[model samples]
Target: MQYQAPVDDMMFLVKDVFSLTERLGDIADFADFDEDLYAAILEEAGKFATGVLQPINRSGDEEGCQYNDGVVTTPKGFKEAYQAYVEGGWQSITADPNYGGQGLPKALHVLIEEMFYSANTSFCLYGSLTGGATQLLQAHADEATKQKYLPNLISGQWSGSMCLTEAHAGSDLGLLKTKAEPNDDGSYSLEGSKIFITGGEHDMAENIIHLVLARLPDAPAGPKGISLFLVPKFMVNDDGSLGERNGIECGSIEHKMGIKASSTCVMNMDDAKGWLIGPPHQGLRCMFTMMNLERLSIGIQGIGLGEMAFQQADAYARDRLQGRANDGEAPAALIKHGDVQRMLNTMESFNKAGRALGVWLGSYLDETFHSKDQSKVKTADIMSAWLTPIAKAYFTDAGYETCTIGQQVFGGHGYVREWGMEQHVRDCRIAQIYEGTNGIQALDLIGRKLIGSKGEYLKVFLSEVNSDLVTMPDSAHKNQVSELLTELEQLSETIISRSASNSEIPQLVACDYLHYVALVTYSYLWLKMEVAAQGKLDQQSAFFFKRILTRTLGLKASIESEL
Candidate 1:
């Protein structure tokens, strides 16, 4: 199945829904970017996603990656595609201009990422990790490390990876046993094995820079003792030339159910040369910065996957003839059937909601990055933190469901590999499992986000929602939005109170709480989009906006049932 970039829909969100131009104008960091230039960039990105990278999606999945003696090679054509990606300047879209990045607002980057993910998620993982690594270095690493590494990484001459999980430890980073012993020359010898390290060892770039977490000698126990390190595959000279091979090596690669095109390797750091990122014993605190961005990125991936699946299924239903409709007409394409239309409509509504939410979250991140006012930055950060897990779990869970629905639309053909629907199902499954399991994500939402800090986060979040409700003019739809807000407040109260009384209550009710939060958030965005579409409701726009409102109502009904 071929992937097509949703350029028109994305442009609608960028220009109409979120007002990207206005937001960028307000940010001092992005003051240099005008809409025309941004559009040109986005156009190029869309072309790359549609015309270049997307065509190779199935081939990559089929060929997978090859692992040899301490070397991992990507699928055929990936190297050339990656070269085109580098030349197009995508790796640096969110990086700093001081280090040769385009320095575009990350909101734009998020939109581009969605298209890239839809086109080829497995290939994009390597670039995603590299960008995350760059963000870490720019934020915390010393001037020397930043100057030496940032340019190459930003330019895509080198790729990056995150090494956090071990066989014994996944979410519980405090249990990690990777040891980093200090050396005489202000370096550390990293000795440990890290598992599930994506792009840990790949031939896609000149050097692989690893942002790993390990425990330093003489440090306290648990997460407090852990620290971040930069362990490159090949050490570089002061002038950025390759110097010597680092001690880190890929022990082996994982054979996974999905994303086989991307190598998930076990990295054995046998006295690997390393430098600490930020303060000692504050690894978890610092790692959370990258992980938080990653969580939301993965969420966008889920939505993108779902959108891709929906597009394919919708096309197939239009082309494939099936049984007659209820009107007793002769057999027509399945899309002519009312029930099939209903399924497609649901998928479309879910996809739009997910996209709008992802864009909103990305705008929040841009605000967090560019806002000079500490209070504004804090507000955006809190809201982003509160919504990150929801975005991750909800979008991905919905993606998996959408993929299954797409398969169901295909009937028995979906179960077989010939239709390619099975691949979508398989690829969408890992989004929920990796990047922290969906169950754990839900627990984090209710347990940590809602009840954490004695409900301060949830309280502040509800205040913002109420503030929006007040500003919205009174209308029937407005009243409906207000009612949803009221229910959300009540739900929050019940969850927080119940969770306080019983430690297990949050876990028991996590799924319900996650659904409630997701529905409420999506409803808010759907309303905004509806209002935006009111004056300019062409057939396409009207159909899309109405379908979203319909889904919002359905999700609202679901939330009430849980109550």
Candidate 2:
């Protein structure tokens, strides 16, 4: 199957739905963005993804990564793809220009990532993890750390990984037992192991940077005592040259169900030479900066895979001859059947809504942090926090389901390996499992974003949703969004009252509640897109409203019913 980047819709969301040309044009950094530059960037990104990455996707997966004598080698062509990626300056899209980046909008970077991820997820991990590390180091790392690491990472000379999960620790980082001891030179000795470390040890880069979480000997136990450190694979000399290998080493690469080409490893930090990024015993706070970005990136992985699945399924349905259409016309292919249309429609609705949500949220997030205006900053922050978990859990869940449904369109052929549809299914499955599993995302949504803030964040979200509906010109989706808003309001009250007596109520209802929030958020985005598209998207918008958006009513009943 061949992959084609959905450049049109991506451009539409950025230029139309978000009103980028108008809203962002006033911003000094985005003032000079022109049509030619925009087209060139997307065209080149799509070309690179298809020409460089897509060719190796299935081949790399079959080859997987190799582990020998504690050395890890990614599948054939993987390293070359990364080299092209860096040489093309793809990693600098959202980086600070001073550090050798183009400094494009992060949301725009998300659009570019969808293409790369859709083309080859394994090859794409190297770039995304490196960008995540850049964010961490820029935000929390000292000036010296930033200077030493940002340029190389931004230029993609080295890759990075987050080393938080130990054998005993998964979502509950507090249970981790990794220890960090103070050294005479103000560095620390980190001794323990981290598992499921993505691209933790790979041969593609000259160096590997690990953002590890460990605790001091006298620090308090659990999450509060944890500290974040930067443990590089090789020490750097005073003259910026590579020094001897550091204490970190890859024990072995994991044999995984999917994204097999990407090296997931068992990382051993045996008295690793490391430098602290932020204040001591305040690691969790700094880690969230990276973790939140990873969470959103994982969600986009789902959307990327969904797009790939949709393309493959849609193409196969049109070309593969099957039963005749029930409609009067003599149909030659399966796509003529109503069931086939229904399947495609389901995939299309969620993918469209999910992708739009991701891009818009990314745009809003950039504004939240970068805008000089105080009022815009405050508004964007609220929406960013509210949508972070939704983007993570909802998109991945929907993306996985989309891929499966797309596979169903192929019937038995979808199950066959040679068809390549099964690979998308396998590759997408891990998104829901990794990056703080979808279940934990639900808990984070309700327990942290909604309730932990004492309903402050939800109020902001509701206000914005209501504002969007009111401002949107009259349309079918507008009323549906209104209904969704009202349903969410009632559901929130139900959850609040129920949780008053039993705090565990969130755990019981978070899964359902998360779906409720996701459906509403997606519906709102559809309505917004429909309004912005000036009726071009009416069909897709209605498909979501009638087919999937109706689920919230049942969710409300589930949330309120005696359990």
Candidate 3:
């Protein structure tokens, strides 16, 4: 299936629904950018995604990556594709200008990322990790570390990996056993093995910088004692020249169910020379800077694949002949079937709302970083934190479902690899498992963000929802969303109150509570899109209101039953 970037839909959200350009204009850094520039960027990004990335996706998947001795070779055309990506200056879109970056608004960057992901998710993973690493180093790395590493990282001359998971320790960082002993020269020697490390040992860049989590010798136990390190594949001299090889080596690469082209390496760091990123014994705090960004990017992976699935399904439905419609004598296309239309509509609603929610979160991220107002920065930070897990968990869950539905549309054809539908289903499956399982995301939402904040974050979210609600005209769609919001607000209070008496209440109901929140949030976004469309998207909006928004009712019931 040919992947096309939905540039028009994206423009509508940025220019109309979200008004991203106008909102970011208040920030001096993004004030000069206009809708025209955003359009041009999306157009060019779409070209790269279609012409360069999409063609290689199937071939890459079939060939996969090869690991021989200590070297990991990416699938054919990956190196050249990555080079074109770097040469086009795509890597520096939202990086710090001080570090050889373009310093563009992240709101715009999110849209471009969606296109890349839709075109080729495995290919996009290589660059996405680097983006997250640069963000982390920019936030926590010291002046010397920043100057030494940021330029190459931001410019895509080098890549990065997040080495957090060990064989025994997956979600629980407190159980990590990697050790980091300080050297006499102010560097540290890291000795440990990390598994499921994406882009850990790729040949796409000149160097691979690993942001690893390890415990210091003199520190206490568990997560708190863990520290972040910048361990490079090769050492650098005083004049920024490459020196002797470091001790880090790729033990092997995983033959994964999907994203096979993206090397998932098992890295062994034997006395690897490294520099500390932030203050000692505060690694998790520092690593969250990268992990949170990665979580959001992973969410976009869902939206991208969902879009691809929908396009393929839609095209197939139009071409594939099936039973006659109603009383027709001759056979008709599958698109004539009501059930197929429902499936297609479901995918469309999820993709559209997921994309909008992603861009909404992206605007907040841009504000968090670029807004000069301290008050705005704090609020944006709170809002982004509250929405991150929702975007990650809900988007992936919905994306996976959308892919399956798309596969169903193809029937037996989907089961076979000939149609490429099954590949999407397999590729999207990992999004939920990695980046903190959706269940873990739910726990973080209910346990940490909601209850931990004493419901302060919930109030911030509802305040914006209510503000938007009042401005919207009174209609059935508006009324349904408003009613759902009220239910959500009341349900949240019930959960908070009940949690005072029971500690396990959060975990018991976390998943359902998250789904409830996501449904309501999507309903709200659909209303905004309805208003923004001015009748253009009326049919899609109606389908969402009548079909998709009703899922919240069962979710509310499940949460109440748990209580």
Overlapping backbone residue pairs in candidate 1 total 0
Model 2 segments more than 4 A misplaced: 328-331
Displacement of residue 246 (Cα, Å) in model 3 is 0.7
Task: Supply candidate 1's per-residue lDDT for 242.
Answer: 98
RMSD of each: 2.5, 1.4, 0.9
Off by over 4 Å in 3: 327-329
TM-score of each: 0.95, 0.98, 0.99
lDDT of each: 0.83, 0.87, 0.93
Candidate 2, residues 480-503, lDDT tens digits: the string is 678778768767876776777889
Tens-digit lDDT track for model 3 on 1-563?
67888999999998999898788889998878899999999999999999999999999999999999999999999999999999999999999998899988888888999999999999999899999999999999989889999899999999999999999988999999999999999999999999999999988999989999999988788888899999999997778888899999999999999998999999999999999989999999999999999999999999999999999999999999988886583478999899999999999999999999999999999999889999989989999999999999999999999999999999999999999999999999999989899999999999888999989999999988898789988888888888887888788989999999998899999999998899889999999999989989999999998898888878888888878
Residues 1-563 of candidate 1 have per-residue lDDT tens digits of 66777777777778877788886577788887776776777788878988877888878889898999999999999999999999888999989889998778777787788888888889888898899889888888889999999999999999999899998998788899999999999999999999999999888799999989999878888888899999999998878899899999999998988888999999999989999999998877887778877888888788878888899899999999888877776678888998888788778767887888888888788888778878878888888888889999999988888889999999999998887788878888998987788888888887787788667777777787778767665666667667877877776787677666667777666776687678777767766776666655334334444554445555445544544
**Model 1 reaches what TM-score against the true structure?**
0.95
Q: Which stretches of candidate 1 lie over 4 Å from their true place?
A: 471-473, 535-563
Better of 1 and 3 by TM-score: 3
